[model samples]
Target: MTEQPARWTEATVYPDMWADPDDDPRNSEGPSPDGELGSLQDYLTNYRLTLRMKCEGLDAEQLARRSVPPSTMSLLGLVRHLAEVERHWRTWLTEDEPLPKLYGKRDADFDGAVAEPAVVEASFRDLEREQAATDAALAGYADLGERVGKDGVAIRELLVHRIEEYARHCGHADLLRECVDGRVGQ
Candidate 1:
């Protein structure tokens, strides 16, 4: 096992989601950029990393374990679901041609998530790909207020929604991971 720094403690510093900012690998020391878009993207980035961090050091079975009972949600499921969410949002933001969903039916991402090694590997890989693609699509737009598509969705709205979506799921992840192995942190 790796030796942890002595400063690490379970005590909460404040009413923040992160229990220990100094020990958190995902904590950013720099201030948010001087714009709404920058701020939104910054939060989104943190949540994305939080999701990945929550799943760290787990085997395929644990990753896919239905940690939350009575609900098909699993860490692996969240990864797959977020991947599809990213893809769908990218299409909406970029007005790109519609792509078929990762899993055909509703909630299929969670339903299909199983304790298979291959599936766990693929889930993480898909998430990374989808997030990168979505980031690329968002890069094309500078004006957060600019609206796109027939529905006329604002870029800022979508960006904020992405952060909100990840934040909600990351909370779920906190419980799920703790249930699995008592591991908890930022």
Candidate 2:
């Protein structure tokens, strides 16, 4: 029988090194912000940082590797999905009228995740750009209680949802990374 290939490679090692939650740059300083922005903002920032840290140092194949059989999730897919989610909440939810979805095929992010260096780089870049846009939009709103979505979601609710979404996905990422290589932490 053929030996199973190692999911993680050298490149994956470095990125993971940089973001180990125990040693993350953001964590090195004392405690994070307190009530400056409120609980929701703090939570969102924490989750966002967690997601980026989880993806740090992983290579294309490692990022694209699914956790196990019957599951299509991948770190790359998570990044792309989060990017879409951020865009949707920041733009669509904030708009006076509903806007078209960013992705035509709902599952394209997952289906398209691949073990290609270029694809992985593009996915990360897209995530960064989308996150920046979302941050800018959020900064424009002074009131978290302001209603934004047609479904009656307030800005605060959407922000909290984004944090929860990232936190959940980061947990998945942690497991996937551990399965790929024996290295595990944060």
For model 1, how does the per-residue alpha-carbon lDDT over 1-186 read when each residue is reduced to its tens digit? 534323322537743344566667677677657777777877888898889888878898888888656999999999999999998997776456778898778899999999898988888888999999989988999888899975789988889889999999999998788777776665
| lDDT (C-alpha, whole model) for all candidates | 0.82, 0.72
Q: Report lDDT (Cα) of residue 4, candidate 1.
A: 30
For all the candidates, what are their Cα RMSDs to the real structure?
A: 5.4, 4.5
List where candidate 1 sits over 4 angstroms from the true fold.
Answer: 1-20, 94-97
Candidate 2, residue 167: CA error in Å?
0.6
| Residue pairs in clash, model 1 | none
Pairs of residues at least 3 apart in sequence or in different chains that clash in candidate 2: 12-57, 12-58, 15-56, 15-57, 16-56, 16-57
